[model samples]
Target: MTVTFPHKTLPWLLIAPQLLVTLIFFLWPAGQAIEQAFYQEDAFGLSREFVALENFIELLQDPYYYNSIGVTLVFSMAVAVSGLSIALVLATMADRIIRGQMVYQTLLIWPYAVAPALAGVLWWILFDPAQGPIALWLEYMGIEWDHFVNGGDAMILVVIAATWKQISYNFLFFLAGLQAIPRSLIEAAAIDGAGPVRRFWDIVFPLLSPTAFFLLVMNIVYAFFETFGVIDATTAGGPGQSTKILVYKVYEDGFVGLDLGGSAAQSVILMMIVGLMTVVQFRFIERKVQY
Candidate 1:
């Protein structure tokens, strides 16, 4: 059955608010960034000169910019894989609980409610080399733990913080997907003498592929963009820029370094990278998804 709106104007009116918001918040800012990418502006923004692709050329040649790109790729992949993997495990465990499921799920989800910056701070405090219990314990175990000075440690800290924040979100979706799977299929697989691991690999996981793929894309996007707060709070791209992802580099250059044109160019490039990633995922990766 086809449901038609009585008036075309009404249909437009219903979407007007969303369209206006997108235009004002997203499209307008994107347009401004694209324009700024081509212009060289001073710190005071009092004078500007169009420089076409100079900012982009400088960035391409700068090794630090390339470092940031590599860091972002590693960070995004780590966060997405670890977050989804851990969440799947938690969701599977939670799915088997016959009691206290609400409490368990609630505790699992509580991390997601924490603000990103706050979560970063929480992890920072928990891993503080001087006083944090975890750091102290690691020290007791004869392993040095210090993110403040070690670049590898700093990267690990940011990755852990980012992944921890995303796990709850992945958990919610994984739980929903797990619940949506028919119980009869599992029962039949069990009757056929399949073990839990065999059933999961052969039947359950295939059905969950769609959910996993969606979470993969979301987690990558989250790690790329939403992790700025976590990095800013914890490492600030410090320990010799080991943890500085592309998004944080954009902020660092534009706001902190006062390189307006370069920062705008970075932002534009980041936008293009994300757009291309989304396209590639849907075009190629989605083929393996079951539903």
Candidate 2:
């Protein structure tokens, strides 16, 4: 009475839709982008020149392009570390609290559900240098806080905004990791006269490493690629070009400047950077994961 099916064919059937969608939506566009990188468009929006690597050479030689790369790396690393650290601390604290845990968890994780663009808009209202809540507060305290001109303040805002958006996601992952640890393990450690620090180091941290590794990669990816909205809203690459991350630069070059070919080169470089980073992260973390 059991139905038999071809397992080999079943796997393809299950993945056929995804593969087709990927081909149509991702691979096709990627191919087009590569093609576009080699051609220059004129005023009439026609491909006027077959430029080969000319666009790429220009991008490589541009100081603004190099500066954008530096800004992107700095912002990405700062957000990743700060977000993961805060999330880990908050997760650990939440795991220990007994009263109103659900309320606190809901509040902490709610930020993850909000759209990044919306979050950027909200922060814009809160940190406006002239008259926003935070800016006004600074002024009231007789503090001179002008993010518009100061690169450091702009970078700090970008990092803080990016980190705030991602901490909830990291928290959710850490919370799940914490919940998966068996109470019996902690009890056994306690029975063996292990103190809080000893138990955490000996047992808790080892179990949490998997979740931490996953969050590290995810947070880095989000901070690198997805914080463009916040940058666009808050700095627009800024008073100068201080906040122009690679993605923002790509958008600016392609759409704003209409230097589609140069932007495509930038895009290709960004793709390579992200792809390399992901490969490196996987190589390093693959050995550390338990299961």
Candidate No. with top TM-score: 1
Deviation in angstroms for 228 in model 2?
1.0
| TM-score for each model | 0.96, 0.91
Q: lDDT tens string, model 1, 176-286?
A: 999999999999999999999999999989999999999999999999999999999989999887998999999988999999999999999999999999999999999
Taken over the whole model, the C-alpha lDDT of each candidate is 0.95, 0.87
Best by lDDT: 1
RMSD of each: 1.5, 2.9
Q: Model 1: what TM-score?
A: 0.96
Candidate 2 Cα misplacement greater than 4 A, ranges: 1-11, 139-143
> Per-residue alpha-carbon lDDT of model 2 for 1-291, expressed as tens digits?
998775888889899999999999999998888888898886467547898999899988988888888988889999999998899899989999999999999999999887887777777677788778898998899887778898887888778788888999999999999999999999999999999999988898889998888888888789778998888878898868888899998888788888888888888888889899989988987688775
Global local distance difference test of model 1: 0.95
Clashing pairs in 2: none
